[model samples]
Target: MTDTTAGTPAATDGGDPPDGSDFGVGEEGSDDPRIEFRGGKWASTLPLVFFIAWAIFQSGVLGIGDTNGLVVGALVGTTLGMFLVRGDWKAYADTIFEGMTQRVAATAIVAWLWAGMFAQTLQAGGFVEGLIFAADALNVGASTFPAAAFILCGLLATGIGTGYGATVAFVTLVFPAGVLIGANPVLLFAAILSGAVFGDNLAPVSDTTIVSAVTQDADIGGVVASRFKYAIAAAVPAFAAYLIAGSAMAGVSLEGAVALRESANALGLVHLLSMGVVIVTAVVGRHIVEAISWGLVVAVASNLLFGLSSASDIVAFTVTEAGALSGLPVVEVGETAGVGGSLYTGAVGFFPLIVLTLLIVAMAQIMIRGGGFEAIQTFLLDRVATTVRRAELTMVLGTATINGMITINTAAEIAIAPYVARIGEKFNINGYRRANILDANTSALGYIFPWAGGVLVGYQVMVGPDGLGSQYGPEMVVNPIEVVPYVFHGWFLVAIFIIAAITGFGREYIPDRASEEVSRA
Candidate 1:
C-alpha cells in the first residue's frame, strides 16, 4: 500500500495552504493493479448509477420502504459491476469483497449499532417517562410547549449528536405530553423535527459532521465553528416560527394524555446521566464507538438500579415458532426467551442499513478504481465550478440535490464527498467551508424531503402501521405527511446556505489563511 498522504504537510490557521499537489485524487492509497477499471470512466460509474437508481426505485418510488430490500439491490448491483472489469477476474472479485469490508464503512456501521442499543436502553429505562415528569413538574403551558420543545430537543440532539435519536425521543415522550396538555399535533411534530436538524448540522459528534470533515480534510472543531453562523442564521427564524405556530395552534388532550401526566416517574431521570456520559466522553475526543458503549453500559445499569424494567426483560429476544427464524438456535418457530429487548431490537434494527452502507462503499470503490471519480472531478473543475463563489454554491446545491434524491443522506454524502474535496481544492476552498457545505445541507434536506431517512425515522416512531400509536392510543399520533409543511428549520437552513453561498457570507478560500489540523475532529 502506498501512502497517498505520503509527505505530510504541517497545517496552519486562517485557511489551508494553496497546496495543489494532492488535488483531484481520491483517498490515500498506493496503486493496486486490479483497481484500474478496463471500462472508461463512464463505464466505471455504471455500478454506482445502477445502485442509486435502484435505491430511488425501492425507497423513493415503488416505496418498498425496507432498507434490507435496498441491501439486496446493492448486493446484486455490485456483483453485476464485475462484468465491466477488464483485468483478472479474481482481482475484481477481491475488490468487491474488500470494499464491502472497508474500515470507513465498518466504522460507521459499528457506530450505528452502538447508538441503536443506547437509544433502546434509554427508552426501556423510562427516559421518556422521566422527561414527562419533569415537563409536568415545570408547568409549561401546552401552547408554549412546542416552542420550548424546539429549544430542549435541539439541545439534547446537539449534546448527543444523533438527530434520529432526538426525533425518536421527543416523538415518544414530549409529543405525548404535548397532546395531553392540548398542543397541536402537526405543529408539535414539526418542532421536534426542527430540533433534530439543528443538532445534526452543527454538532461535532454527528455522523454527518464526521463524514463531512474527514472527507474534506477539515478539523471537526473548525467545521462546527465555521457552520455555526449558518445554523444560527437559520435557527433564529425557525425558533420564532415555532413560537408563532405554537401560539396559533390549540392543544387537544387524548385518553392516555391524562394517564401520562398522572404516571410520570422521577426515578427514570437517571438516564439523563447516561446521556451526559455520552456527551462528555465524545466532547473529550474519545471514539464515538467507545463513547456510545459507555453510555449503553450506564443506561442498562440505570434500568436495573431504577427498576424501570427487569434485567432479563432488558435483554430479552423472543423466539417464536412461527417467526421468520423459526429453526434458528434458541429462536424456535413455536415458542416465543423474549430475547428481543429494546437493546436487542434497537441494535438489530440497523443491520439492514449497515449492510446497505457497506455495499454502497463497494460501489464507491468501483467508481474510484474505474476512473469515474476522476471524470467527475475533471468536469466540475473545467466547467461549472469556475469561480470561488460559484464553486461554493455548486458544493452547497450539489449536496442538497444528491441528499434530496437519495433516501439515505449518509450514502448521498459518501457518494459526493470526493467531488466536494476535489472541487473545493481547485478554487482553494477551505476544508471547513467544504465540510460545512457538505454537512449542513446533508442534515437539513434529509428531514425536509418526503422520501428522506430522517423524516421516515420519526414517522415510524409516530403513526407507522406498527408504531406505538396502536399500543399507546391513536388519538395522540400525527400523520407524517401532514408534518412536512411545518418543518421550518430544515427548509430555512437550506435557504440560509443558498443565500450564504451567493452573498459570500460564510465562504472562505485557502489563500485566506492556513488550514487547521483535520485530525483534531
Candidate 2:
C-alpha cells in the first residue's frame, strides 16, 4: 500500500523562512527551457484536455466504467498531441518514454500487483466466509453493517498504508459478506472507499503523504500528526452519515441469505491472523512488498493446512493435454489451456489499470515539459491569488482539480507540488499546514471520481469474470458512478479543507513554528 518509490530525494532544509525572503520563491515561474508548442504554451494542455474529455464522456455520459476504455482514450489523446509539438518530433517521443518510466508510475504499478495477489490469496483462504461468520455471530444486521465495515476497513487501510490495497482487499472479501447480510451494495462500496480515503490522507507511509510532506519540506511524522485533526473531523461525520444512511437505505433480499449464514464456518476466521501478519509487518516499517509477501505465504499455507482450500484452488495449470505434469497438484487436463490461480487472476485484474496509469503519466509529462503547469501557476499567482486566504484556497482547489483529472493521486500530487510549495511560501504558511492542504484534497478527490484509480481498482474486482458478481449475483457489482455521491469521507474531507482555507481553522504561518527536518518515516 505504501508506494513510495526508491531513490526519492528527501528534503534537506528544515523549513521555509518566516520572512518570505528568497526561499522556495520563484520556483514555479522561473525561466527554464521547455518544449515549444504550435499555439504557445496553452497548446501543451491538449493531451490532458482530450484525455479528461474522453474520461468524462466514457464514464459519465455513456456510463461505461471500463478502465481499458479509458486506456484507449489516453492512447488517442497522446497520439493526437504529437501533431501539435513545434520542435523535433523525437523530443515528444522521448518525453512519452520518460513519463512512462517515472518512479511515481512504477510505484503505483508495483503496489497494485502486490496488493492484488495478497487480496486474492486472502479470498482463496476464505476471508469472506470468515467475515460472514463473524457478522452472523455478532448479529450485525444490514442497518449497522456499513458503519462497522467503515471502521474495520479504515483500521486495515491505516495499518497497511495503502488505500488501493485496502479497497482491493475489502471489496474482494468484506463487500460480498456485507451484501449477503443484506447491506445496500452501493452504500457499502462507498463506505469502503471512504475508509480508503481516510487512510490515504492520514497514513504516514502513504505515497501521497510522502509527496506532500517532501514537497513542502516537512517531516513525515509531523505531517501525519498535524493532519490527524482534519482526518478525524471528516471521519466522525462520515461514520455518522453511514449509520444514518445504512438504516434509511434498503438492501436486496437474496434467496439464500439465511442459508449462507447457516452454513458459515468460524474456522475460516483463522485468516485474521494472516491479515494481522501483514498489518503488523507493515506497521513495523518493513516494505509493503515484503509485508504482503509474508501475508500471502501465510494465507496459502493456512488454506492448505486448514482444509479451507486445495492447492489447485489456490493455483492451477490447465492444459489441453497434461503430459508430464499430469501428476502435479497444480496441473490438470482441461478443454482449454491457461494458468489460473489467486495470484494470477489477482495480478491480471490490474493489467489495464497499469497501462492506463502509464499513459496518463505520459500525458501529464507532456503538459509539464510543454510549460502548461507554468502557465497555470502564472495565472493563479498574477490574477487570482492575491491574499493569504485566496492563496490557500487556490492550493486546495488546484490540487483537487489536478487530482480529478489524473486518476493516480500520487502522480497528481507530484504534478501540482511545486505550485503548492510556491503559493504557500509566498504567504509564509507553515510547512505542515501546506502539506495538509496539499494531501487532503489529493487523497479525497482520487477516490471520489468514477475514473479514479481507487474506484476503478475496486470495480475491477466486482466485475471480473470470477468476481463477486459471478460468485454472488449481478447485484453484488456496484457501478463506479453509483457510489460517487455516497463517498461521504472524501466529500467531507474536501469540504473541511475548503472551510479551513476560508476560515483559517487550522492555518499556521511560518512565524508560528518551523518544522523539523524532513525524512522518510
Candidate 3:
C-alpha cells in the first residue's frame, strides 16, 4: 500500500503543529504495506487477555477477593508474553524487567509518597468526620440509601479529586454502617466504587481526568464539560439501580434515621469549605494534583492552627499511620496525638491499593512494549473499525478491554487514550467527543467487573474484620459480602454506556482541527 497524504486540518487547524506533525502524521513508513502484522504483536496482547480472563474467573466466578489471584494473573500474563515473543528470551526478560521498572516501579514509588502525605494529613484533619456528617444528613431508608450514598460519595470524590482517597474514606466510614443498617454491604460498596469512578473520570482535579485532557491536548474544562453527557448517561442508570437494590435489600429500615440525623447535625456538619476549596479550584482549571494538594494543605492547616487538631498531634498521627501502611516502624509517640494518629491511619489505608495499581500498570506496559497492542490495533483498524459506528464500537471495546486488564480506571485511561484519539481522528470524531468517550468508558468499566481495582478495594473492606463492626455504629443489619449480589449500580452503569454507544444518544462535541495540537510537547 502506498502512503497517501494523511487528512489535513479542517478549517480550525485542529491544534496540530504548524507542520501538521501531531498524531504521528508525516512520519514516513507508517503506511508501508510490508509492515505486516507480526507474531510479536499478537503475543504482546496475550498476557493482557490472559490476565483479564484469570481476573474475571478469580473475582467474578470464584468470588475469591484475595490479592493472590491478581498476583497470579500478572505472573501468568507475563509468562505468556515471554512465550509468545519470537525474540530472544533474554530480551523479553529484560523488557519485562524494564516495563516493571518504568511503569510499576515508578508509579509505586510516587504513589507511596503521595499516599503517605495525603493520608496522614487527611486522617489528622478528621476527614472521616466530614463523611459521617454527610452520611448522617441523608437519613434515607434502606431502599433509597444506595442512590443517596452513590451521589454523596460521587460528589465527595469529585470535590476531593482523589478516588482512592474517597474509596478509603467511604470503605472505612460507610461500608460497615451500610451493613449494620440492613443495607447490603456489597451493594453499598459498589455504590461507593461507582461514585469513585464518577469522580475519577470527570473531576477536574482527578489524576485520570487531568492526564486525559492534558495528554489529549485539550483544555481541562472542555474535557469535563464535553464529558458531561457521557458521565451522566452512565451515572443515571447507576443511580436508579442503587436505589432499587437498596430498597429490596434494605427492607425498609428507618429506625435510626432521626438519631443519625440529629447527631450528624449536632456536629455542625455543613461547613462545606474543605470540599468547596477542592471543587472550586478544579472548576477554575487548576492542575488536578496541585489543586488537591492545596486542599490537603488547607485541611492540615485547619486541623492544627484552627484546632481541627493540634499541630503536634497531627504530625504524630500522620507519622504513625504512614509507618503502619508502609510496613515501616512507627516510633513511640512523644507528645502529640493527632499527628501520630493521622499518619498511622492514612498509610495503612492506602498502601495496598497503591501497590496493586502500580503492578497492574507495569503489566500493561509490558504488554504494550511487547507488541500485543500493535497486533490488536492493526486488526481493529483494518477490519473492525472500518466505519464510524464500528469505529466507535472499537473505541468502546478497546477501552473496556484495557480497563479489564489494568483495573485502575485512571491508569487504564492513560494506557488506552492514544488509541482512542487515533481511532476517533480517523473517523473525524470530535476532540471533546473522543475525550468524553474515552473517560466515560474508563469510568464505567473500572467499576463494573469484580477484578477492577476499585471494586476489590471496596469488596475487601466488607469482608474484612474491622470493616463490619467499627465503621457502622449500632442500629443496622446485613453481612458485608452478602451485598455483592445486590450491587446494582455497577451493572447499570455498564448497561448505560453500551446503550448510549449503540444509539449515539446525547453526543455533544466532535473533534475539531485544533484537537491535533501538541500541547504537551
Q: What is the TM-score of each candidate against the true structure?
A: 0.80, 0.93, 0.75
RMSD of each: 6.8, 5.9, 7.0
| Cα-lDDT of candidate 2 | 0.86
User: For residues 338-365, what per-residue lDDT tens digits would candidate 1 score against the true structure?
Assistant: 5666777677666666666677767766
lDDT (C-alpha) at residue 167 in model 2: 97
Q: List candidate 3 segments past 4 Å from native.
A: 1-40, 83-87, 101-138, 214-217, 251-265, 268-272, 287-290, 297-340, 460-497, 506-521
Q: Write down the lDDT that model 3 would get.
A: 0.59
For residue 317, give model 2's deviation from the true position in Å. 1.7
Ranking according to TM-score, highest score first? 2, 1, 3
Superposed Cα deviation of residue 309, candidate 3 (Å): 6.5
Q: Which one wins on TM-score?
A: 2
The candidate maximizing lDDT is 2
What's the TM for model 1?
0.80
Task: List runs of model 1 lying over 4 Å from the truth.
Answer: 1-25, 28-40, 43-64, 72-95, 172-176, 179-189, 247-255, 317-338, 459-466, 473-484
TM-score attained by model 2:
0.93
Model 2 lDDT tens row, 52-161 = 89998988778788889999999999989899988698888888997788777877888889889889988888888889999988999898999998888888888778
What lDDT score is found at residue 390 in candidate 2? Answer: 96
